[model samples]
Every structure is written in structure tokens, then in C-alpha cells.
Target: MKDLSTFFVKDNLDEIVFSNRNKAYGAYALRNEYSSQLTKALFVGVAFFASVAVIPLIVSAFSSDVITDKGHDYGPYILDPVEEIPEIVKVTPASSVPVKVKTVESTIFTPVRDVKKNKPLPTEDDKKDAALSSETSAGEDTKLIVAPPAIKVGPPTVAPPYTPPAKVEDPNIVVDGTKVDVAADFKGGINAFREKVAQNFDTESVDKTGMVSGVITFVVEKDGSISNLKVTGSSSEFNSEAERTVKAIKTKWTPAQLKGKAVRSSFRMPISMKIE
Candidate 1:
């Protein structure tokens, strides 16, 4: 009954619950200072937010950023005045214009000459009346004529006839049998050719022929015909008979070759016989 309302004991629930029950504990102390801590944190938060919002405004007010008008300045236009020109008058002649005169060249006339002509012989009557003279007579109306030349009495001198130079022997020429790449050979062979010669040779025609031995030489022509036939031996008749026997063999030969080309080549063969 003693004015309990007027004596209002303001004790929070945490304080009232912790009354005389270990107020020294950390939880109790934290509970008691919670209101003061909350008020201090609120004031600090408001100051931080206010400073953040006002810093840009404070810097802009002190900075000098001058803004000038960017419009271009142009001068007043001055137009140039145009002057009028008068038309020119021209005069032309009604007649055609004359051209310059040119000089003409003249050509000289020349007469052509004709072959020598013989004058007619004077008659006996004319010779009696007029004396013979060497003076030239008037020319005929034809082209300019010349007099005939006088004839010589003796044999006239003649230019010597041109003699042609001697022909040069061909360098790519016929070779001897020893010099040819491939020696000229008879159709069969040298032995076969010799056999034919011995068979055809006339031993009876030879003079004192006992084992007659001779060497016959001939050329194998490009056409494979025998040419330049010659024989050497003691008896002339034996030589002649040997040559005749070799000629009687009608078979052509294989021409000798030098550098793979057919060429004439000299061939030699020794012949022997007995006429007993």
C-alpha cells in the first residue's frame, strides 16, 4: 500500500532474472551493457553512411570546372559583283581562199645508141666524082648509130682458156686393206676365193711354170666390183693368167668399211701353182 506506482523499479527481464544469481558471469555483464552498445553502434553506422554520401558533394563545390559555350563564330558574308561582257563581231570573205603556187621540174632528153652499122660501098661513078675521105658522114634518122670496127689483117690475139684447179683428193677416201676397220672380203671368204682362183687358173698358158707363186693386188670398189688389178711375178704370162683367173670370178665382194661407211680398199692375195 505505499504508492508502488510512484516507486517504479525499472529492471529489465535479463537483470531481473539474473538478480543475485552470478552477475559476475560474462553473459550477465553482456546482457546488462547491450542497450548502451546498441546505441553506440547505431550512431557510428549513421555517421559512416552520412560521410560516404556527403564527400562527393563537398569535393565538387571546391573544384573549378569551367564550362564555356562551344558555338562557332562566323563572319558576315560578302558577295562579289559580276561584270557583263560584250559580244565580238567577225567578218569573212565570200570567195574561196587562194593556195600557194608550186614550181614544176623539167627533164633533159637523151638519145639511145644503136648497134654498129656498115655503110654502103661507093659506086664507080660516085668514086669518080667525089674523092674518098675518112671524114664521118651524117647519121640516119634512126637512133644514134656507130660505125663498124675495122677488120684486122693477121690472126687476132685470143685470151687463154680458163684451166680449172686440180681436184683435191678426198680425205674420207679409200683405205688400204691393212688400214680399214673391216677388211674387204670375198663373198665366201679369202680361202674360198683362193680355191676358186686355183680352179679357174690356166696353168698350160704359163711359161716354165713350176709351183708358180705370185701376189695379186686389186681394189674392192664402193660398188663391190674389183678394180685396179695388178700382179707381180717372175713370168709375165703367169701374171697375165693369174689376173684373168681372178677376173673370171664374177662374185661381188663385201666392201671394206672405215667408220662404218663402205669404202674402196686395196686387197692382196698370193697365188701358187704347178704346171708339170
Candidate 2:
């Protein structure tokens, strides 16, 4: 029994030593892990600071070189020496000799009249007799003088005043044969016709189907009336609507002028229908 107790006691001591060594190793491992983590954190912090500081310095160095090169190519550095070039010499031209021009002389003919000698003065009776004789001689000279024929001028002809033709009234709504006034027949202008058509037009009729555009030709008589209503062209979709609207339009337009007189003239109107 004593020997068995001794063996048990030895085994218990060995177990306690192994347990203590394991705990010491665990503590060392924990310390080494903490130290490693701290070292890594410090290294990371230093690298971050170095990158932030060095990147700007690197960019600054490259930027400085770029600025220097730019100055060499595009800045005032390349222009400073260009202002020192020597000016070119200009030579003066020699004076030209003057040339003399010659003058020519021409003869002109003029008639000269000789002066007659004055007659001696006579007595009063003699002077009266001379005056009567001179009067008879003047009358004889006047009879010898010949007169030129008279020229006749005719009076200028005047043009007749212009009178506007009477306005022709349209007998039928369709206005088939009667001549109509284009400007006077259309009561409202083109703008009025467009407004009326737009106001009365059925949007549903067009929108449900489509749109149609057509050119209508009609004559306006001297008497503010529309005639010869006909569609020149139209789209098939809204042709009926366009025709109806055009027929409904009772536009009174101004009659056309011919040779300064108001006359019936043809007018072309465009009708369009659009669906919203």
C-alpha cells in the first residue's frame, strides 16, 4: 500500500507540471500575437502617412517639370530672344528728270466794221426836213425787211380717269359660272377663314380617323362673292371634313384689279384638318 501511494503521488506531480507549462506557452503565444498586431498596425499607419506625403511631392516634381517644359514651348521664355532681331535697311529711290511740254498757236478770223463820218448840223427848218426824210427812208427799209413764218404747237392729250367695275353678285352658294371678287368676296381674310374652320371643326372626327390637307381653288367676283369652289388636292382620310369645311367658309375677299379697274379674279386656298 505504501508503494502504490508513492507511484500515484509521482504521477500527480508530473500532471501539474505539464499543466503549468501549457499555461505558460499560451500566455507567450498571446503576448506574441498582440505584439505582431501592434507592429502591423504601426507599419500600416507609417505606409499610409508616407503615401499621403510622397504622392503630392511626386506630383509636384512632375508638375514642375511639366511647367518648365511648357514655358520652353508656349510661354514667354521662347519669345524673349525674338525681339532682338536687327531691322532691315531701306534704300531711297533716285529722283526722276522733268520733261517740257510744247505749246501750239492757231489763227482766228474776226470781221471789223469801219466807223462812218458824222453829218454836219443844219438849221431848224433843215433839221425838220431831214427828220421827215429819215422817217420816209425808215419806212421804206421796214418794207424791205422779210419776216419768218410762224410755227404752230398742238395741245397735249389727257388720259381718261379709271373707273372700277361693278361687283358681280353670286347667284348660287356653289358659285358656278359667275365671276367673283377675290379680295372683296372674302368677308374675313384668310386668317378669319382659318379661325372659323378651326373653331367649328370637329376634333373627334379627325382624331378618330386621321388628318387631311387640300388646296381649294375658287373665284371671287367683283361683288364679294365666292364661285368655282373646287379642291385641287386632298388626303383621303379627312377629305370629306376638308371639303365640308371649305364649302362652309363664306369668306369675302377684295376683288382683283385689272387695268386699274376692279375685276373678278381666281384665288387658291389651302384647307387642313389635324386630329389631336
Candidate 3:
């Protein structure tokens, strides 16, 4: 029989552990067979290029919507006399056009006094009673005498319709720094305002890649002069430019009026800087 010391011998341990370097352990061999260095590198390169290409496309799509600034009004173009449209001659009779003729309706209630066709003649007792009543004197203060109720004649003269006093807006009142009555307006209207901006503003530094919305708020003082100019928005890069554009408008505005008096008014104007 083999002894326990023989199984624990150093020679047996060396033969099992240090036999070969080429053949790996079971777990190591499985991992080395499945993994590939070239495959991993290819996957990483594709992901990097995909992310870089997608960014510029997103910017271009969003930039189109952002480039729009507040538009100008073109109300000064009036039609000439030659452009007037004359009235059309009726093809059919005037009666052919379906006219919704309104009918006048009046429902007046009138009391009717009817006389019986077959009234019976008065009896002898009724005749006697009528005679007795007629015989009574006008000066008599008898219990049987009853006076008829006095009736008011004709419709009471309709008193002049009560008119509420006109709503008087106080000029001093400022709602969100603005007057509710006659709002503030540029001297020559919106078109004139746009022309002034285009002629004066410096557009070289403005970016066209993305939309940067901002607001230029200013107070139109009582003397038809502008003051308190400010610029605010999400992008600070354009704030200085917006401030410069609004301040350049040296033209006096028509001051807002409330209660027939000029008042200091605040205006919030949106500034959209786009490459036109």
C-alpha cells in the first residue's frame, strides 16, 4: 500500500505545475481565445467619428430658426388711383342675391270692451235700484258710495338714459413700467425705426451659427426723449452689441399719453441679430 508521505512528495508537485508554458490554465485560455485587440480599436474609432459628425448637423438645423430678428412693418405703401377695383355689374337681378330681409314684429296688448249680442233686459227690482242710486244727491256722504281708483295716464316720460361717466385713466399709473392708455410709439412708426437700426448698427461681429435672442428695454421719458437703456438675454456675447444699437437711437419717441397728458413709459423690444 502507498503511504501518505508519497502523495505529498515535492517531485509529484513539480511535475503537475511546471510541465509546459505554451498551454494556459482553463480560465486564461478561454479569455485569450475570445478577446481581439483589433476589433476593440475599430469600435472605439467609429464611436468617436460619429459623435464629431453629429454635432455640426445639430448646430446647422437649430441655427436656421435662431437667425430671425423682429420684422419691420411696411404700411407706407399706398395703392394708386389706377389700382382701384371698380364695383362689379350684377350678373343676375338684385333679387337673385339671397337677402335676409328682417320682418318688423310688434305685439301690442290692447284691452277689448265686448258687448253681449243677447243681453237680457233689466228686471223690475234692478230698475228700482238704479232709480234709487240716481236720486241720491252729489253732496251726500253715504256708506254705499265708492269712488273709482285714479289711473296714471300715458307712459311715464322715459327719464334721459343714465350715462356712466367715461373711464378716466390716470396718467401717473404705470403698469409693468408702461401706460395702458396710448402706448409708446417711435416718431415715424416701426418702419422708420427698422431703417435707423440697419443704417447705424455694426453687424460684422455677430454670429450666424446659432440664434441668440436678447431684449433691449428703455424708458421713453415725458419730454419725448429716451432714457434707462438696458440689454438682457441668454447669450452674454451679444449683450454689448444690443446695448449699443438701442443707445444709438437718438430720435425722440412720441411719449405715451394717459388722460391727455404725456407720461414716462417703458418698452420691451426683442432683438434678433441675423445675417440677412
User: How much lDDT does each candidate structure score?
Assistant: 0.82, 0.62, 0.70
* Model number with the top lDDT: 1
Predicted structure with the largest TM-score when compared to the true one: 1
After superposing candidate 3 on the true structure, give the runs of residues whose Cα lies further than 4 Å from its correct spot: 1-178
Q: For candidate 2, lDDT tens digit of each residue in 1-276?
A: 546775577546555656656645665555436757899999999999999999998898877543343334554444355566788889889888888899799889898899899776555744443434443232222223458898787988789999999987553333322343223434456677778877866656554545557777777777767667667544443555655766776655676654465766667767766565
Q: After superposition, how far is residue 206 of candidate 3 from its true place, in Å?
A: 3.5
Q: List the lowest-lDDT window of 10 residues for candidate 2.
A: 135-144
Those runs of model 1 whose alpha carbons end farther than 4 Å from true positions after fitting are: 1-172
Deviation in Å, model 3, residue 23 alpha carbon: 99
Predicted candidate 1 versus true structure: per-residue lDDT over 219-267, tens digit per residue = 8998889988999988899999988988898999999888888888888
Report the error of model 3 at residue 181, Å: 1.8
Residue range 158-227, candidate 3, lDDT tens digits:
7898999999767655444454488878878967886787677666656544667777787888877777
- Model 1 scores a C-alpha lDDT of 0.82
Q: Is candidate 1 or candidate 2 better by lDDT?
A: 1
Candidate 3 residue-wise lDDT at 74: 68
In model 3, how large is the Cα lDDT of residue 69?
Answer: 78
